[model samples]
Target: MIVTISDNNKNKTIEIKEKKLISTILSESGFSFSMPCGGKHICGKCKVFAKGNLSEPSLKEQSLLQHESKSDIRFACMTYVLGDTEIKLINKETEILTDGYFSQYDLNPSGINYGFAVDIGTTTVAVYGYDLKEGILMCKDSFLNPQSIYGTDVISRIQSSIDGNSKELQNVISDKIQKSILRLCDEYQININLVDNIVITGNTTMLYLLLNKNVRPLASAPFLIDDFLGRDVTASQCGFTHLNNANIYLPRTMSSFIGSDITCSVLAARDLIDDSKSTLLVDIGTNGEMTLFHNNQMLCCSTAAGPAFEGVGITMGVMAESGAINKVYLENNNIMYTTIKDKKPIGICGSGLVDSLAVFLSLGYIDESGYINIDKGEYITEYNGKHAISISDSGNSITQADVRAAQLAKAAICAGIYSLLNEVSLKPSDVDRLIIAGGFGSYIDVKNAAIIRMIPEELATKSIVVGNAAGAGASMILLSEKCRIENEETAKKAEIVDLSTSPYFMEKFVDCIMF
Candidate 1:
C-alpha cells in the first residue's frame, strides 16, 4: 500500500490498505488533482499518470486521456489499486497568497464552537473551518470530486445517472465530504457531535448530485430543476448522518443552469456595493453565471461559457494546477514565465490565459482586440521561441487556436456583463463597483483582467475578486441565522434573466470576439 509521487528530487509517499481505492489514497495523502464533477468521470478530470500494475487504466480513463494525450495516462478516481504504485502529483501552481485580501476578523479560539462551510465546485470542493464566536476561519481543506468518471459537464453526468450509476456518483461526493468534515473535526480537536453545523453552495448539478435526485429534467429543456432554491435539511438527508444529525443549509437558486452557488456569491458580494450604487457580481466558471444590482433590485442570468475557461476542451489546457504556465512577463523586452511549482511549463490555466494576454498587451505584442500579429517581423523572439505566436514548437503549446478559445470564453463573460448592464439601463462606466468571485477570479490580477478586456477598462480599479466567496457565504450561514434567511430571500428577489433566449446574445458574443 505504499504510493510514491516524484518529479525530480521531490518525493512524497502515501500508504493505503487493500480496501482503499486509488482516489481516496491520493486525497488522503494531500496530493493535488481535480475531480471537477465529484469523480463521476464525466468531466474527464482527476486524471493521473501512474507507475506499476495499478497504472493500467480503465476504459473511461482511456477516453479522457485521449483528450490530453494518446499515451498511457489514467483517471485516478476510476483507477483501482492492485498493488502499491508511484504517481506524480499535480498541485495548484500558486499558493493562496493571503495578503491584504481578507479583512482580519477576531475569532474566539476557546471551547469547540466551529462550523464547516463548503463550496462544491464541479471541478473541486473547498472546505473552510470557522470559529463561531470570533467569526474567523481557522483552517481550510479541498479535494477533487470522485464522480468525474461519469462526465465533465452537468448534462453529460445527468445522462450517466440515467444508467443506474447516479446513486454511486452521489455517494462518491458525499463520502469524500463526510470524511473531510471528520478530518477537520479531529484536527481541530473538536467533537463532531458538538460542531455547530455545515453549509453548502454549488450549481444545480452539484446539489442534485449530493441529493441523488434524478437530473434528467435539468439536462433537457425546459431544463426545470425540482427545487432550485434549497431548504435546511438534516445531515441524514444529505448523506451526512455520520456527524450525528448535522444541519445542512443550502443557498437559494434561480434555474437549472443558474443555481444557488451564484446566489451565495451574490450575497457575499452585496457588501461590495453601497446604496445609491450600481454594480455587477460575476461568478465565472464552466457556467458563467452573474447578477446585476442596480437601484435596489437584482436581475440575474447565466451564459454557457463552457469549460474552456477552466482549462477544458483545449488541446493543451488544464485546470489551475501545478506546472501550469501562470504568467508571461516582459523582462528586457523579452517574454518569460514561471510555471506553477516552478516546474517546466506544460499547459495554461484560465488565470494564466488572462496573464498571458496582459503580458502580450503590456509589451505591445497583442492588440487590445486580443489579436496577435502573425507577422513574424512584428515581434521579437522570446526565450528563443520557447513561446511564440503564429507558430508551434512544444507539445500542447499556446497557439492561435488557443487565443480564439480564450477569446470566446472572455467574450461570453464580457458580453454577459454588457447585456446585464444594458438591462439595468446603465453603461459599464455607470457601475460603481465590479466584484469577481471564486479562487480563479481572486487569483487573477484585476488590472490585467481589464487590460485583456475581460471587464470594462474604466472599472478596472473598482473590480474586486473575493477568494472563495461562495464558500465564505456558506460559512456565514453556518454561523448566523440572519444570513441563512437572507440567502433564501435573495434567491426570490433575483430576476433570472435567460440569456440563452436572447437574440442579441449571439451578436454580443461575436462582437466581443473582435476585441
Candidate 2:
C-alpha cells in the first residue's frame, strides 16, 4: 500500500507492506508525529485527512471529532488503512533549536583531539563536537528524537520497551546519534574516524531506552535500577560501526528518576556547589528534575511535569522553532510577541506559553484563581468551536484545556521547588541563586516564569539560564578527564529525595495548581 503526506504544496509517498494504522505507517516512514497521550487516542494532535479506502473511525474517533462534519478527518493512530491512501498532515514541519549551547567550566584538553558530547533528551537529541587539541567547541547540532513517534515522555517509551519494542527504540536513537556525529564531521570537513570519543548524558529512562535495557523496573512503583551507573563502551558495541574506534562514555545516573542529566548539570553549574550560599538547579524538561545545594550537601528530586512545556500536549504547542511564538507581552494596550526567527507564527512554545499566561493575568484576561474571562477578553477567539485566546495573527490560540495542562506542569515544577526548600528548612528568600537548565528553561523569560508562579518570585532576579548544562557537562567530560572524575564524585555526594512519599509534597502540589 502507498501512503502520501501532502503539505505546503508538496507530497511525499511511502510504501507499506501490509494494512496498518496510519500512525504506525507514519512512524515507520520516519516522520515525528506528536502522540502526546502515547497513541492512546486521548490526544487528537495526530488527526489527518484521508482520501482513500480505510476502515471506519472508532467511537473514540467519533467522540473526538463530534463537533466537526468533515468525514475525511480522522485520528491517524486510530484509523486503519484498507488500501492505498493520501494522508494530509495537519502538523507543520517540526523545527528544533540548533544553537544556545553554553558552559562555565574551563576547558581541559585530553589525549583525544576530537570527540562528541551528546545530550539524549526525551523529546530532542543534541550533540556538540569538541576540538580538544585547541580546547574549543567546533560544531553543535540537534534534532527531534525519532523515538518520539512511540511516545513523548519516558514512561510511554518504557511501556513500549516492556511491550517488546526495545530493539526499535534503541535502533532509532542509535541511528540519529551516529548521523549527528557524521553530520558534524561533514560540516567541519573532517574525517569521522578522527573523532575518538563520545560522552553521553540523559535521564535514566532515556539512557535505558538508548541501551535497550529492561525498563520493566521503572514501569511501576518502587522504581528500581539494578545498574544505573555509567559505562564505557565502543561505537561498535552499540551497533554504530561507522565511527569505528570511538569510545562511548555514559555519565553516572543519580537515581531511578534523577538521572545522569542532573549529575552532568551539577558538573556544569558551579554555583550550585558553593558553600557560602544555598542554590537550586532545575532542568525543566519532560521530567522536571531539580537539585538543591547547601553547605556542600546536595538534594535532588524529579517530577513528572509532562510534555506540555516542549509543545507536546497543548492545542498549538510547539518546540522553540521557527514560526513558534517564544515571547509575549503587552505594548501600549496591544498584545506583542516574538517568534523564534521572526517568521510567520505557527504555534506557541514553552516560553511563549508562560509569557502568554503571565500577560493574560496582568491584563485581567485571566484571574489569579485560574479563571479565564473568556466572554470579555479582547484577545478571545474561537478555536475548534471552543473559546480560546489568540496569541498570533494567524488565529492560532490557546484553549482552556491547554491552560489547564500548563497549570498541571507548572504546578509540578513549583511544587518540587518548594517541597525541596521546605525539606531543607529554608524559604524561597533563602535561595541565593536558581539556575534553570534544559531547552525550555534556557529560552523562557525568567520574569514571565516567575509571574506565572512556575518559579519563585524571590529567586527570579537570582535566576540564571545556563543553556543545555547537561550537554555542556557532556562536552566537559568528553574533553577532560578531570571533569569526568569530578562528576562521578559529585553524583556520589548528591542525595535523591522521593517526592512521592512526602505528604508535604502532595499538599504543596495541590496548593500550587492556582496561578
Candidate 3:
C-alpha cells in the first residue's frame, strides 16, 4: 500500500506492505503529529483529511467526530490505511514565543566557530544558532516536539518511558533537534563541522528522556534522580553524529520536577532577584514551576497544572496558532473574540480561555461556583448535553467541563504562588514584581487572568511577561562561561517545597478553586 501525506505544501509518499495507523505512518515518515493521549482514542485532536482505502471509523471515532463539520475528517490514530491513501494534514503554523528578556553578559565563547543553544520545552523545542567567533546570533527556529506523539505532559511522557518506549522517545527528540540544527546551518551558510559547542536545557524528565535514562524513578513516590545532569559529553554521544567535534552540555536540574529550564529562567531574570525586593518567577503550562527570591532566600515549587491551558483537556481548546482564538472580551454588552493573525476562529487557546471565563463571570452566565447558567445569555448553546457559550458561528463553543478544567489549572498555579508567598510571610501585595515566563504566559492578558483568579488581583498590575526566558538563558549559558557557572549556583541556592506534603498548599488549592 502507498501512503501519501501532505504538509505545508510539501508531499511525501511511502510504501507499506501491511495495515498501519496513520499516526504510526506519519511518525515513520518523520512528520510532526501530536497524539496527546498516546493513541488511546482520547484527546480527539489527531484529525486529518484523508480519502482512499481506509478502515471504517470505530464507534469512538464516530462519537469524537460528531461535532466536526467535514465528513472527510478522521482521527489519525483511529484510522487504518489498508491500501493507497492520501492524507492532508491541517498543519497550522504555530506562533512560537522565542524572544525573551535577559541581563547583559560579556561574550566568552567556549568554542571557536559556531554554537547552538536549545531549550527543549514540553510542548515546543526552540533552537538558536550563533557565530561563536564574532559573538553574533545567526538564526533561530522552533518546532513542535516530536515526542508529543507519545503524550503531551511530562507525567504522561514519563509513564510512556516506563512502559518500555524510552529509546523511541529519546531518538525522536534527538533526531528532531539534529534536523533543526542542520536546517539552521544550511539556511545561514554555516559549516556543520565548525559548530563546536551546544547547550541544552529542559525539565528533569525531558533531559532524562533525551539521554534515555531510567525514568522509573520519576514515575512514583519520592521522585528523586540519581543523576542531576550538569555534565558534558560529545555530540556523538547524544546522537548528533554530524557534529562529532561539538561538546554538548546539559545544565543541572534543581529537583525531580523543577528542571534546568527554571534554572535558566532564573538566571535570565537575575536583575529581579535582588535583596531590596521580593521577586516571583512563574512559568505556566502543563507543569507550573515557580521560584520566589526574597531576602537572600530562594524558594521553588512545582505544581501539576495539567495540559488544560495548552488545549489538551478543554472541549474547544487549542495551542496558540493561526485560527486559534487568542483573545476574548465584551464590547457593547456582546461577547467578541479575535484570533491569531486575525484568522477565522477554530478554537480557543489559553489566553482566550482565561478571557472567556472572566467574561462569562462578569455577564452572569457562569456563577461564582462555576455553574453555567445558559438561559441568562443569548449566545448560550448546548454542547454534548451541557450548557456552552458559542464563540464563533462555525460551532466552536466552550463547554462546562472546559471551565472546570481551566479552574483546576488556574487553582494549581494560583495556590502554588500563594503557598510560596505564605512561606515567606508575605502577601501578593508584598511582592515587588511577578515575572511570567514561557509562551503561554507571554500572550495572556493580566487583567482577565486576575479577573478569573488565575493570578492574584494584587499582582496582576505587577506581572511582567518574559517570553521564553529559558531559551534566553540557554543562549546566555552557551555564549558566556560566567553565566554557565552562575546557573549552577542558582540551582544550588533553590530550596524545593514539596507541595504534596504541605497542608497549607491544600488549603490554598481549595480556596483558589472558586473564582
Candidate 4:
C-alpha cells in the first residue's frame, strides 16, 4: 500500500505490504491518524479515501460511510485491502488562524487600520481584528491548531520532539501557521508590515516551539523553562513573515506548562475576577488550565486532561469544523445532529461529545457507573441497521466507547476542580463566579455541562464564558504597554498545583468517572 498525505512533505511516504492496522501503518509512516481512542473502530473520525485497488469500505466502515463517504471518503481506521492502493487523508479545515504573523508600522485613522492579534493556543489559534487609531477590536475568529502534524495534543507534539525530529516538526507546523496568516493578510487587502505588533499568547511549550527554542526539558522532570517572558523578535526569524520587523510580546509564565496565556485569561477577566469575592478562571483547551481566587491569594494549575473533549484522542473525535457533528438530540428515541456547516456529518467534535454524554445520561443509554450496555444492541440502534452512529446524511450515534472517552476527559477536568476545592478546604459552593475561557468553553451550554457532569453543579450555576482569553490578552498587549508588565506580576503571584503527582487528584478522577 502507498499512502500519501496531501500538502504535507512527500519525502515521508512509506510502502507497506503487510495488512497492518490503518493506525499502525499511518503512525509508522510519520503520518499521525489523530485517533485518540486507540482505534477501537467505535469513533468514526479516522476517515480516508483510497485511489487504488480494493477501494470499497469494510463492514465496520459501511455504517459510518453513509454520513460523509463520498466516492472519496472512507474511514481510515477501518479500510483495508489485499493489494496495493493509494490512500488520501482528510485535510483539517481551519479558519482565521492568524493575521500575516507580522506587525504594522503605523495607523490608518480614516479607514480601518486592520491591526491583527494572534492567539497561539495548544489546541487552536484565534485571530482578531482591531482599529489602529481607536484600538478597538472589530471581530474575532479561530481555527484548529495547525501543528496537528506532530500529533493532536501538545504532549504528543512533545513526544514527536523527543523522537529527535523536533526541528522538522516545528518547521512544518510553523510554516502552516505562517501560510494561514499570509492568506488572511492578503484577503483583507492590508499590507502585512502595516500591522502594529504581533502579540501571541500560548502555553510555554507551544510558544517555545514557535520560537524554535529547544523544548526537550518540557517533556518531563521538574519541567522548567529558560525564561518567563519575551518581548522582541522579527517575524521572518520565526518563519511568520518577511513583510515587517515588529516587537512581539509574550506574557510571563508561572510554571513550565502554565504560560502567559493563563495570566492573559486573568487579564481578560480581571473585571470579574478582581471584583468578585471568590472567582475561578478555567481556561479549557488541550491543556486544562484553572485559577482560583480566595481572599487575596490566587492559585493556578494545568491538568493533563488530554484531548478527548476537543475531539482528538478518540476514535471519531475531531476539531470543530464543517461536517463535524457539534450537537446531538434524542429525536424519536434516536440520535439526531446539528452539524457545523449543514454538511453530512463525518465525525463528532468536542461540543458534540459533551452533548452526547448529556443526552445518553438523560436517556439511560449509559449506566450510572458509566458502563455502556453493549449487550442491549437495540438501545444502540444502527442507522438502517448499519454499524455507524448516524441516522441521516449528517447524523450519527455516539458509541459506548465514545462515551467512555468523554468520561475519561471529564474525569480529569472535574478532578482538577475538585482538588482545587480540597486544597482550600472549601466546596464547589464556595466559588462565587466561574469564568470559562477558550473557544470551546464559550458556546457550550453551562446547564448541559453540569447535567453531563463535565462541570460541578455549583460552579456551573455561576459560570460565564469568555471566548479566547489568549487572543484577548494579546489584543491588550498590542494596545497597551502596561499589560505586558502586569502579566509578569500576575504569573509570579499564581501558586502552582501539580495534578500528576497528587493522590487527591486520582481519587477525584475516579469519583467523577461515572455518568
Candidate 5:
C-alpha cells in the first residue's frame, strides 16, 4: 500500500506493506516523530491527521482524542494502515544534540590501529571514530535514542525492561550503534575490518539495558547492579558481525546512579582536578550527575533532574535539533530569539527553555515565585489548551507547567550542588573550576543559567563549557591506554552519594524551588 505524508505544506509519498501502522511507515520513510511514551498510546505526542482507508482508533486513542478535544487528530502510533492512506503529521520533527564539552589532553595513539568511542546517553547517542595510529579523529555521528519511544527517563526505560521489553530495547540501541559505526567507516573511507576496539560509556541502567541485563534491581529500594565494572565482549556477542573481531569494552560504573559516563567525564577533566583548585564536573540532563574533587578525594552524586531539561514533558518542547529555539533575549522591550541550524523556530530546547525563563524573569513577565503575571496577557498565548507566555512570535510558548518542570529540574540540580558543597564544608566560591559537560551544557547560555538561578551566580565566572566530555573521554580511552588506566583508578577512588536518602536533601530541594 501507499501512504502520503503532508508536512509544512509539502506532501511526500511513502510505500508500506499491509498491516503496518502509520508510525511505522513514517519511521521507515525517514520522517522524524516524537514517541515520548514509546508508542504505547500514552503521552499522546505522536499525532497525525489521516484521511483514507484505515482501521478504527483504539479505545485508548479515542479517549485521548476526546481529552484533547480535537476530533480530526489521531495517534499515528495507534492507527494501523488497512489500505492506502494519507497522513499529515501534527508533531514537529525533533533534532538531537551532538555537541558537548570534552577536556583536551595529550594523546599517544601510535600503539593502536582503529577504534570507536561511544557515549550512550538516555536521550541521545554519540559515536566518535578514531584513527589511533595517526592520533586523529576520523568521523563522528549522533542521533536520538530510539528507546525514547518507551519513555524519556531511565526509570521509565527500566520499567519497560522489567515489563519484558529487554530484547526490544537492546535491539533498538544495538542496531543504531551498529549502523552508526558502518556509516562512520564509510564516511571516513576506512574499512570496518581494520577497527580493533570499541569503548562505550553510559549511565548504569543504559549500559545494563544495552546488554539486555535485568533492570529490576535498579527499579526499587536497595538498588543493586549486576556489573559495576562492565564486561569484555566481542562485537558478535552484541550482534554486530561487521566487526566480529573488535573488542567491545564498557567502562566501569561508580554506583547504580553514577555510571561510566560520569567516570569517563571525570577522566576528561582529570587535569582540572588538583589540590590547588577544587573542581566540580556536572553533566546536566535527565540525571544531573556531578563529581567534585578536593584534596585528592572525589565525591559524586546523582540528582533526579527529570527529562524537562532535555525538552521532554513540556508543551511545545523539543530536543536540540534543527529548527529548535536555542536562545532567547530581549532587545528594546522586544523578544529576540535564535534557533539551531538557523532554521525556523519550531519549539524550545533545554538551553532555549533556560534562556526563556531567565529572560522572562528579568523582564518581570514572570514573578519570583514562578508565577506568570496574568496582567501581561500580551505575552501569554494558548498552548496545548492551556495559557502559556509567548517565547516566540511564531506561536511557540512556555507554559506555567513548563516553568514548574524547569523549577523541579533546576531545584534537584542546584540542591545536589548545594549538598555536595555542604558535605565538603565549602562554598560556591571555593570551586575554582566548574566544568559543565554534556549536550545541554554545550548549548546553554551560562549567563542565563545563572540568571535563572539554575546555577549559582557565584560560579558564573568560573563555569567552563567543555563540549562532549564523555565522548571525548571515551575517545581518549580508545586512543591511549593511559587514559583507560587512569579512568579505572578514578572509578575506584570516587565515592557515590545517594541523595534520595539524605536527611537534608528534601529540605534543600524545596528551598530551591523559587528564583
Candidate 6:
C-alpha cells in the first residue's frame, strides 16, 4: 500500500507492505502529529482528511468525529489505511515562544567551539546555538516536541514510558534535537563537529526520558528518582551521534515533578529572588510548577493543571499557532477577538481562553459558579449538545465543558499559588513580584488572568512577563560555568511541597474552583 501524505502543501509518499494506522504511518514517516491521549481514542485531536481505501470509522471514532463538521475528517490514530490512500494532514504553523530575557553574566565557555542550549518543554523544544569563541548567539530554532505523539502532559508521557515506550520516546526527541542542531549548523554555515558543548534542561520526567531512565518512579507515590542529574554526559551517550564531540550537560532536577526547567527558570530570573521581599515564580502549562522565595527560603510545588491551558482538552482549542485566537476582549459591549497573524479564527489558545473566561464573567454570561447561561446572550449556542459561546462567524465556540476545563486548570494554578502563600504565611498582597515565566505566560493578558482568578488580582499589577525564562536559563548554563553552579545550588535550596497530600491545597483548590 502507498500512502500519500500532504502537509502544508508538501507531499510525501510512503510504501507500506501491510495495513496500518495512519498515525503509525505518519510517525514512521517522520511527521509531527500529536496524539495527546497516546492514541487511546481520547483527545479526538489527531484529525486528518483522508480519501480512498480506509477502514470504516470505529464506533468510538464516529462518536468523537460527530462534532467535526467535515465527514471526510478522521482521527489519524483511529483510522487505518488498508490500501493506497491520500491523507491531508492538518498541520498548523505553531507559534513557538523562543525569545527570553536573561540577566547579564560573565562569559565562560565550557568548550572551545560552538555550544547549544536546549529547553525541552512538554509541548515544545527550543534550541539556542551560540558562538563559544565570541560568546554570542548564532542561531536558534524551535519545534513541537516530537514526544507529544505519546502524550501532551508529563504524566501522560511518563505513563507512555511505563507502558514500555521509553526507548521510542527517547529516540524521537533525541533524533529531533540532533537534527535540529545539525540543521542550525547547516543553515548558519557552521561545522557540526565544532559544537563541543550542549546544555539541556527540562522537567525531571523529560530528562529521564531523554536519558531513557526508568519512569515508573514518577508514575506512583513517593515519586522518588534515582538520578538527580546535574551532571555532564557525552553527546554520543545521549544518542546525539552527529555531535560526537559535544558534552551534554543535564541540569539538576529539584524533585520528580519539579524538574530542571524550574531550576533554570529561577536562574534566569535570579534578580526577582530577592531576600528582602517575597516573590512567586510560576510556569503555568500542563504542569503548574511554581516557586515561592521569601526570607532566603524557597518553596516549590507542582500541580497537575492538565492540558487545558495549552488548548488541549477544551472543545475547540489549539496551540498558539496561525489562525489560533490568541486574544479576546469586549468592544462596544460586544465580544471581540484577534487571531495570531490576523489569520482566520480556528480555535482559542491559552491566552485567548483566559480572556474569554474573563469576558464571559464580566458580561454575566457566566455566573459566579461558572454556569454558561445560554439565555443570557445571543452568542450562546448549542455545540456538541452543550451551551457554547460562539467566538467566530465560522462557528468556532467555547463550550460549557471548555469553561469547566478552564476553571479546573485556572483553579489548580490559583490554588497552588495560595497554597504556597499559606505555607509562607504571606498574603497575595505581600508578594512583591509575581513573576510569570514560560512561553504561555509571556503572551497572556495579566488583567484577564487575574479577572479569571487564575492569579491573584492583587498580584496582577506586580506580574512580570519573563518570556521563556527556562530557555534563557539553559542558555546561561551553556555560556557560564558560574551559572551552572548556581543552577545546582538553586535546586538544592528548593523545598518540595507535595500538594497531593496537603489538606490546605485541597481546601484552596475547592475554593478556587468557584471562579
- The C-alpha RMSD in Å for every predicted model, in order, reads 5.6, 3.1, 1.2, 6.2, 3.6, 1.4
lDDT of 5 by residue, 107-177 (tens): 76423578888999888788888887777777888877777766788998999899888887787788889
Question: CA lDDT of each candidate?
Answer: 0.69, 0.82, 0.90, 0.68, 0.81, 0.89
What TM-scores do the predictions have?
0.80, 0.90, 0.98, 0.79, 0.89, 0.97
TM-score, cand. 4 vs. native:
0.79
lDDT of model number 2: 0.82
List, residue by residue over 140-189, the lDDT tens digit for candidate 6.
99999999889888888998898888888888899999989998999998
Q: Give the 10-residue window scoring lowest on summed lDDT in candidate 2.
A: 93-102
Rank by lDDT (best first):
3, 6, 2, 5, 1, 4
Encode model 1's per-residue lDDT on 185-299: one tens digit a residue: 7888867776766788888888887888878888777777667646776676676658654566777777888777777776666567676888788877777788888888898
Candidate 3 lDDT over residue span 1-515, tens digit each? 98889998679999999999999899888889888788888899999999999999999998987888887898999999999999999877888999988888889978889999999999999999999878788999999999999999998899899898898898899999999999899989999988999999999999989988899888887998888887797675676657787889999899999999999999888876677899999999898899998999999999999999898888888888899998888899788889999987888889989988999899998888888897885879998887898874645788888888888999999999999999889999999899999999889998999988888999999988888999999999999999999899889888998998999999999998999
Over the stretch 1-515, how does candidate 2's per-residue lDDT look in tens digits? 87887755646898877789988887776565666676887666677888797898788888877855576898888999888899987645555543443455556745466888898888878888888787677888887787877788898999888888998888888887888889889989867777778888888988887787788888887997897667786676565758776778889998899999888878888644577889999988888999999877899999999989888778888777688888898899788898877888877889899999998888877887677788765799887788888874655688888888999999999999999998889999999888888878887888988888898889899987777788877877887788888888888888888999999989988888888
Candidate 4 whole-model C-alpha lDDT, 0 to 1: 0.68
Ranking according to TM-score, highest score first: 3, 6, 2, 5, 1, 4
For candidate 3, the 10 contiguous residues with the lowest summed lDDT are 233-242
- When 3 and 5 are scored with lDDT, the better candidate is 3
lDDT of 1: 0.69
Residue 393 in model 1: shift from native, Å? 11
- Candidate 4 structure quality by residue, lDDT tens digits, 221-336: 88867777656666765666453644555667788888877777787677777544878888776677899898778888778777787776555666777787878777887766
